[model samples]
Target: MRRIAMVTLAAGVLITTFSLTTTPADAAVGFWRTVGLSGVDAFGFYDTQAAKVTLTFDLKDTKKDGYSAALRFTFTGTKKQKDDVRVVALTGDRLQDKWQTVTSTRLKHMYVQECRGTWKKSKFTIKKCGAWRRHY
Candidate 1:
């Protein structure tokens, strides 16, 4: 009985040691909202497991007249994070242009900041602004 107890204690110590020495894999998945024109808004999520991201920058406008107004999708982060960046943009003729998701093996971050702009044409000019969430 004493021998069995000793063996169990040793096994427990070994398991604890292994667990402490192991490092956890980073597998954080998060999403951000994009508010654009009536039909130009979108949302995206990213995985932070690998060093490279598969869907880094991608946007699509299913609205027949996505170009009727300007749209903007900005990436956001906490104040400590790097400067906010534009992940997707659409305007003028490009608004109606075909845009697809592109995989990038660059940039790795835990969190991202996001904002969207709606295109309310004024005198036939596309205008985008605001940091709010909207369903396209």
Candidate 2:
């Protein structure tokens, strides 16, 4: 009986140790806009193993609206300060489907916003923007 109890305790301890050490699955957050003549869909995920953020965008406009799709990413660093802000605009073929990966060790949280923009003189200007969403 004593030997059986010892074996069972050892097995339990080993299982617990393995479970605790195993890496966690990636986490994701997303938003979409399909009500207007144009549409935009996006998802953001945190890759645990890679220690990075991956953002995917899908833009559609069957009506051929002049406006373009855009995504803005605001990353907060470990010091609780805004570290980086980036804006990506997609037009024509590039607007259909796109994905971007951000690798930054200092990134602690991310704020995302979707917007519609117009191009003029080789510059993209945001005309409308949606509410900001946050992910950590």
Candidate 3:
């Protein structure tokens, strides 16, 4: 009786451990909303087939200051194939493009004294007034 009870307990523990480490089927969805002094822009849609992101930049009044260029981009990072999840980071010239882990803190903390930048590609444009973060 004692041995049978111990075996049942061990099986239960194994099952519980497996369940706890398992991520949900849709756990990799990525979404984000951007807030700046110019206004608020939201972008992203759920995709369970793969991890994807839709981005929107509003250049509404920025053109008059010689920086008016708005863009909407939808891009999916390269998946590992074995896993359906994808991850991307903004670096190099793309650093000014959007909020990455390092750049976001500077923007959010109001450390930008003077921003001198230009958009080389529509996909990489900077918002002077606010910070952006991943919604997911």
The best candidate in terms of TM-score: 2
* TM-score result, candidate 3: 0.28
Order of models, best lDDT first: 2, 1, 3
- Mark the 10 consecutive residues where model 1 has the least summed lDDT: 108-117
- Evaluated at residue 114, the lDDT of candidate 2 is 76
Cα lDDT for residue 83, model 1?
A: 33
Location of the lowest summed lDDT over 10 successive residues in candidate 3:
105-114
Residue 65 C-alpha lDDT in model 1? 45
Model 1: per-residue lDDT, tens digit, 35-87? 43455544566554445443343454446543432333333334665633334
1-136: candidate 3 lDDT, tens digit per residue: 9999999999999999999987677444343443453322323333233233222222223223434323222222334322222123232332133432211111101111112223555444455533323333
Clash totals, every prediction: 4, 0, 3
Candidate 2 runs further than 4 Å off:
1-38, 48-63, 93-95
CA RMSD for every model?
9.6, 6.0, 13.5
Quote model 1's TM-score.
0.38
lDDT comparing candidate 1 with the true structure: 0.46
Error of 3 at 85 (Å): 16
Q: 44-114 in candidate 2: lDDT tens per residue?
A: 45542345555444444333477777777777766755478887877653436666565544446767777
Clashing pairs in 2: none
